[model samples]
Target chain A: MDTPHPGPDLHPHCTIVPPYLLVRLAKLDDPRFAQAAAAARESLLRDSQIRQLRGGEHPFTYSGARTLPARTPGESDRTISDAGGQERLPGRRVRAEGQPAGSDPAVNEAYDSLGATQALFWTQFGRDSIDGLGLPMDATVHYGKQYDNAFWDGERMVFGDGDGQVFNRFTISPSVIGHELTHGVTQFTANLQYEGQSGALNESISDVFGALVEQHTRGQSSAEASWLIGDGLFTDQVEGVALRSMKAPGTAYNDDVLGKDPQPGSMADYIETDDDNGGVHLNSGIPNRAFYLVADALGGNAWERPGRIWYNTLTGTGLGRESDFAAFAAATAATAAQLHGIGGAAHNAVLQAWVTVGVMTGRE
Target chain B: MKVIVSRSGGMAGIRLTWEVRVEEQPDPATWADFLNSLPWDDVTDSEAAPDRFAYRIRCAPHEVVLGETQVNGPWRDLVNRVRAANGM
Candidate 1:
């Protein structure tokens, strides 16, 4: 009931790939990965420029003028745009609701991913869309020339054709699409501050739903899931499985060019640094692992019990924008208790998961 | 004189740095002339967007940290020049 009302400056430029990974990519000297390096540099430059522009007065505001047609509970309205290898927002309208599949694979992928994400929220949670008000889902593909990342820019989802050498098209990953859209859900709900612990929680929530969408789409139980964030985003040339792994945090990638995956799965390995907004993407491994533990213990579809507990915590009144790991863990435990029972297996599992991840959840 | 430019903030919260030594440039006089025409001391910090970048420019004896909204005119010009010189 008490949703966050963040100031105008609180909205973050939520991107799927962390900057450290891109920085490592930009610093590579191998000739075979020269294109990847160039793309990384370009993405960094473009990201910096966008941040600068956003800081100015009268930052670009979302114009939610286009409304989707009224539909049944399970139906969705989706639109996919093509940026044509340029840096722009909501580019040329290439596909609309009920339109046949397009020629470009990227366009079709975006459309289908949006539908799948919508279906997950609607069918399982009884929520309509990102805003929980049947908002029209919009996306843009081929955003920039070899852009190395994807982002949710506070308005709509934007995907990029990654450097073919190290990364693939962002639209190719369903979990990634779900991850970006979940930022919208967070924006309208918890509105967590995008720095320090809260930022890490923000990132974790997206990863949670992202993994859930993938598992739901594939009809996989918790035991059958891979628990990877960006499984298909990487190319074969890179010696990596995915961008990040919920099952094994730091074991996702250890490539020479991309550097080691810096995620830490517990508080014992928590890194205190001024970089990466106080390690939002890095420290998120702790909570991610906690979720994985809960899902594994429950032994069924993750979106059923674990998903409900996490989602309730996120949208519940107990959450705050500045909530740290302990606070968030406490909230999840309380939500699990409220949803199940005071001393049920789900609540106990939630508490034990946090403790296993080195986060003390009993504190205030 | 030496100039070091650092950029911080953004979605990733990564900081990027670039430096230029005035004496090492091919046209030191030109560089000096460009630096002299700007009102570096009068510039003030401005409001920054959430998750946006701020810049810190240290020109020998003088240093200033300014948010992206504060960048304009000579400051923007100087940042662009330094970034281009460093091939960033």
Candidate 2:
């Protein structure tokens, strides 16, 4: 018997993880945290080297692999490809710039998301694309048979048809689009290594903006926002609301097989593990909570003052490849101070948020 | 031999594991041959891509970890069989 597909999740936004998880970097006097920093660095170097060594392996069939920013000051350049269930990438050109919606839901959804994400960076942050120079967004959908994951390969966004047991489809959630695309943005900007604390930061950065992309499109305030990542990716068989909750960490889901949400919103409960890049997805709960707190305190559209502070810190060049949670917290506080004056509402909100999350020791 | 397959580090950061006791399978010899066919020596556990599933396969004393892309051919064969045997 065939099951009726409920279709793609329309309003919900979800982003899964891709943390490097080497050493987690030392934080809050915890000497045990090497979380995957070294491995993360090694992997990043190896990935770049692989790119150089493994050229011509993927078929560059599409001409819009990168659409230039010459059309207008803020126009988006996008290309969507279909893998047709083979493992190869950038499979075949199915859609291009300014194409009408096709019968396939995955293609249409990806196209709309790319446009929305591009619009967020352009209108809100005055930035061009994933890169400020207006990098064209490229994505491949329907990759592999029941391939339950979506990832960014430092070049294009690759999405898969979920197994239909636990997940629906990668494109079901708009936040996932923002989340994966934000990984591109992070690579272009701070380029945080994906392991441990920095890895968690990498994941958190994507979630922060992933939610922002959703909120901006829906015009929802911080209070009105769901603050849940991967909200509707799970099937009815799984007992979960979303993948992770930014407002309340570790409260997103609880299932018999998937187990409970292992995310921790504070350092005291920080999970130290060798998997998930030293719990890059788990420990990210701390920073995600911090951002939510900041937005809650600011009491307006989160994309306005709160997002500006985050956007400035992200592009300010203050973050290093190995920057831990504390360093990132300090940078955001400084950015808030510089932008909204010391002891001002935004600055205080940043400090209080970090302190609450145990990233920073005090309200400094 | 007991084979365990643990999947972690995806977009959701959730982990699911399944295992099969090769000795208890209907065709133990065939399962062992398939398990032994995996390219274990070539797996370097350093490279991890963002938001991809990482698999840890442990068959007795020999253990190997592979990213999502590497789980094909013999590797995919081993994982799928294990999950099926375990009724996962």
DockQ (C-alpha based) per candidate is 0.08, 0.63
**Kept native contacts, fraction for each prediction:** 0.07, 0.64
Docking class of 2: medium
Residue-level lDDT for B2 in candidate 1: 83
For candidate 2, the per-residue lDDT at B32 reads 84
What are the C-alpha RMSDs, in order, of all predicted structures?
13.8, 12.3
- For all predicted structures, in order, the TM-scores are 0.73, 0.84
lDDT of 1 by residue, A1-364 (tens): 1122221111222112235545766798888667767766776767666547634211122122112233554568899999999876889999998999968999999999899999887777766677655668999999878766677776688888987987899888888889889987887667777778988898889889989999999999999999998888889998888878998889888887667888899999998975455677778889999999999988888998899889878766677668899889989998988988887989888988998899973443
In model 1, the Cα lDDT at residue A133 comes to 50
For model 2, the stretches where C-alpha displacement exceeds 4 angstroms are A1-69
Over A224-330, each residue of candidate 2 has an lDDT whose tens digit, in order, gives 99999987889999999989999999999999978899999999899888778778888999999999999999987888888878887877656766789999999
